[model samples]
Target chain A: MSGLAPVPDAEHESVPIGSNDDVVRARQLVRALAQQCKLSLVDQTKLVTAASELARNTLVYGGGGVMRVGLVHRDGRVGVTAVFEDSGPGIPDVDQALTDGWTSGGGLGLGLSGARRLVDDFTLQTEVGGGTQVAITKWAR
Target chain B: MLKIGDVLLVSIQVELEDQVVLELQDDLAARIVDSGASGVVIDITAVEIVDSFVGRMLATTAAISRMLDAQTVVVGMRPAVAITLVELGLSLGGVRTALTLEKGLEILARRDDSRPAQL
Candidate 1:
């Protein structure tokens, strides 16, 4: 971490998450942005992996949505941020959704919790029948 | 897909889509039988991510290979991918893994060498 820059730039890109192919596209977008931020190999892998998990969740569980990737400079370090949004039937329990081994789909139930562990910061908000939003950030160290 | 010394080698270099993973499972299964390979080494060095579906496919492939008399060794898993797998609660149980392709082949060769000779 270095001294904070007076002005930080946040480069952003958004992609739809309608199908399985879109999930891979989101991963590619985030991977490029993470590289632009100059994050280390491990950091890049973590962010991209997290993005993959979340993107899949958005498509399969949320019935499709959009993923936004951004490169952010804050706290004296550059980082990557991803936000996933879906307008399908939202989760009824945020806590349960974040818990490991809790999956409504036929999966290993590691999507949400695993993504959280891979990133530096995570936030989730959902309402029944409304939609779901998840934000994750990974800062270069 | 490549075969060397009765071992099937697959190096996955791209971000695996869900369908691609499934196709891999089918192809590997068929190749294992067609080639009469006793060992299978899937090199994932270039693979940056392994979601639950892909993880399950690997494990399933390993299990199926064993039934067909081939030992499956998944090699070159990145550190981040390993961490994410654990966090995702997928143990990839029953799947053997190695740090490198050379090591993966060595494990298979050892198994071959240790087997009893037919009378």
Candidate 2:
């Protein structure tokens, strides 16, 4: 909670993630937000890449979902966070899914873990037959 | 896309859908076969992002081109794209990379020049 931005005040935007185009748009939206927040180039790339992976997972694994992006300020540092949510079949094992080279799809198996490594903060919540939500953040440095 | 000397130059300037990425792979491979091109220079400077999917496609295309006796050189990778790619664990293996398109062409020319001319 220390790193969480003041709730109910930060500017937030949501993008629908249903298709490839949606995923692209999600990345673009996140990139613009990170840029607006004055994140360094590398920091922006990390956040955008994480957004891309999560957005793709939302589409391919969850059968489509929604992405929420917001500018955040924590510990006197500016940052951005993106939340990916889906109501599809949830992950049976969140730990396993976060492992590198673990993939339920035909991808390179780097989406989840790699994304985790690129960002400053990460959180995931899921339940079998319930849903999945992943939130990631990167603080500008 | 532009063909110059024995090298094919492709500038990716748009946010490509997955299908389009696949199509580009096919088209580049086919063109390499048909034109007998010795090299391919891909410029991604205008690209805003390099997701894992695009990374895989690029590496796959380079592998295919090598099989077709064509070398592949990717050029103009922005710093951000490079960082993202590394963070994503995509090293773009088997693909030669250059800092700029001009350097990429020079690399291909040097390799092509060193080869014994097939009369």
Candidate 3:
């Protein structure tokens, strides 16, 4: 229920999720980081929702996960990066999971792809026997 | 900590993040519709910041309020929320904004007065 101890310039924050409320709080911190980057409200909201969905997926399907929030600087530009990692059973088909309305779990199925659409950068890495990780970054653009 | 009336005009105090915001807003729209009150004023004061998701939720609530045929006004929106919305180039759609619930009510009442006396 705690996040990676956030420092003004930690570059990364890790949060452990054991409950539903924990997911929400962790994601909120990520959003705060996004806001600190001075992203537009649209971008800020997009990042928060994406992080929230990923965190929720980790909790709902994976029994909990660790959310990594960080600040990224690239080419004189600053951005917020969020990485959600879950060690639970991984997705068999990452492509299928990204498709909208393709949920076998009866959700809106907008969790992955929808999240991807909200930010400037989206990357997903998963392993069948390992776990699931979704990384997203939103810049000032 | 957002409220509409004396009894929590809005109870989706779920951190004002983007996820679950639409769901929370949907629930709020349904509750306001069901309350049968002529007007519903939402106070997002506690939500010191409004990101895109929160903005969309507010706009969605406004559209739903119109659909439910109820008067809706957003009151006590924080400066941060307003700033974010402006930066995002977002809108609350047709939702009205007020500095306080009483002011929102005053606006709603004024709108009601000019109505065709139908609703």
Candidate 4:
């Protein structure tokens, strides 16, 4: 999945995750793009749910951020990618943050790991004092 | 929302935002106490996705209802949502679910019948 990029003229949108309503909008935007990608119903639901988790993390843990979504094509296969960037206290332990049922906030600790499981590709980049950026993609079968 | 017999019904028809979900939880808890209802049925037929935050709200609402002496049943979960939820690793062990609103009410009714009569 590395080096793959969005189709030159495909649709792209960005939604800010500043509040709960923004999170809902992010989910709606991802759902629409996933539909445009012609993902199956199950795949669409998975991608939207993953987006929801990440958007909430951007708001609750990251103290607000933005989600950028686009449609990517590779090898004749179409996919949707969402990138969540937040400039909050970066995760000190990426591995622990990805562990199931491990949370630094008042959550079920399933956000990061669970989102990873629902997508085709997942990437996490963070620094102790910098920020966190999570990129995920779901390709249509 | 509706009240039928001793049960309260909440049908979620919109995409649930985090604040709305939290408000629903608080409202349901208050309504349960005010009506002294014995069962609560939450219908989510219109919901297309169930993230961990929403999943946690359902579980937390059920627990609150149980503490209020009311059985809570979530109904009308989409198949895709179910599949995604399992893959997301949230079984919602503390909450009860049914396929439809009628079945949810039935489950609540059966539980009521099985309970020993109070003096």
Candidate 5:
């Protein structure tokens, strides 16, 4: 796997997907962004699914948050990277947060687990006092 | 803070927006699998047309649900939607479909009852 330029556009498309309503907005951007990257139907679906999961996390668990979406390239295929950051009560345990069927909100057992599974590349940075940031990527390959 | 269940159910209404469909597919799929209700019925009654992204999400969700040992059936597919999905060659591949949510559920029940014997 190759690395991407920090970002694609000069200014990333950032939005507050705080409400359950905002998840759709986030996904529309994902479809558009994925299309622009020339992603195939299967790859596009993967990316968009990952985006939807992350956006849902922002709204349901984080209690409202922001997602920064941008384009990038790596491994000879175009890619889109969306970074979700929230200032809400941060995760107390990162390892547990990454596990499947582990939801503080009594969720559907997908949450972070499904999102992490969908993306080609997934990374998370979080702490007790320091909020959380999740970056996920999907490529044409 | 919002609830995942509320959000998942509300996604049924937000079907009007293509983007919303993409963003909530997993959450919705997760809820359906966990519910043990046989399968999921994606009510596309509100959508006038089927876009590539939406079609792709449906296919993806179905595939994911299959891995979770559940089925994903698309419901309320209008004639126009079906024609367009076909013309676009948007086959959900392994996913199943029916004219309405009720029909989809019936399909699931049949599949479940005949499982080991059919195989």
Candidate 6:
């Protein structure tokens, strides 16, 4: 989170994650931004895949939400950042949620932990019965 | 999707939705039983991303096909997708993969030959 400059609203796009189609749109949007940021093909794929995982989590676990994606710049380095937010019941135990093979939903339980691995920076904020927000950034190298 | 000889070939040409993937799994399972196909080839040459969900779908589909006595081979994965899958910690165990559909068919054919004569 440190050293990353704030992105203007014009540079960011937000897509709703209400259904399966929204998840696919979020992935496509992230891929477009990653490519525009000049990230390597591998990096772009990783970021896009991570975004897809998070978007699905927002829809399935979070009970529908929105994903905001934008280009980030830090000290001559460029990156793509995606944030997923939801108003559904937040996670009660983040540590357990981040652990591999732990899932509250029917998924294989790899979405949260696996998305963290694919990105350079990952952060999560949640409050039980309130809401949740997860942000991830992948810098070009 | 098409049936070639004793194998079912499925080429994914568009971005996959979660529900769609689930439906595909059920459909493939039913098709395997109905067609009595011994092999299933899923081509992902046009797919650009393989997330945890899609990865799980592939594994689950393979497992379902296996239960029906069919070998499943996923082919044509892009290099970037492979790297991402590894980094994401999804090895997609239990799902066999090949570089091309042709190679996948060959593997299945070999497996079919190696199976002991049906009693």
Runs of candidate 4 with Cα error greater than 4 angstroms are A1-11
**Candidate 6 collision pairs:** none
Which of the two candidates, 1 or 2, achieves a greater lDDT against the reference? 2
Using all chains and alpha carbons, the TM-scores for the candidates as numbered come to 0.89, 0.93, 0.61, 0.95, 0.59, 0.95
Ranking by DockQ: 4, 6, 2, 1, 3, 5
| Candidate 1's DockQ | 0.60
Angstrom error of the Cα, residue B24, model 6: value is 0.7
DockQ score of each predicted structure, in the order shown:
0.60, 0.75, 0.13, 0.95, 0.08, 0.89
lDDT of 1 at A132: 83
Model 3 in CAPRI terms: which quality? incorrect
By lDDT, highest first, what's the ranking? 4, 6, 2, 1, 3, 5
Model 3 C-alpha lDDT per residue in residues B1-119, reported as the tens digit of each score: 23344223653344654446766777766676556555667776666455444665677777777787777788887655565455334555577889986788788777767768664
Which run of 10 residues does model 1 chain B get worst, by summed lDDT? B82-91
Off by over 4 Å in 6: A1-10, B117-119
Off by over 4 Å in 5: A1-8, B1-119
Candidate 5 lDDT tens digits, A2-88: 123244455579979877568778888888998888877666766666677788777777777888898876656678889887877
Better of 2 and 3 by TM-score: 2
B1-97: candidate 2 lDDT, tens digit per residue: 6899888999998887788899999999999988889999989998877888889999999999999999999999998889888878888878899
The residue pairs found clashing in candidate 3 are A4-A14, B4-B9
Quality of model 2 by C-alpha lDDT: 0.87
What is candidate 5's fraction of native contacts? 0.02
- Candidate 4 TM-score, C-alpha based: 0.95
TM-score of chain A in every predicted structure? 0.90, 0.92, 0.89, 0.92, 0.88, 0.93
lDDT of each: 0.86, 0.87, 0.70, 0.91, 0.67, 0.89
Instruction: List residue ranges in candidate 3 displaced over 4 A.
Output: A1-10, B1-8, B11-119
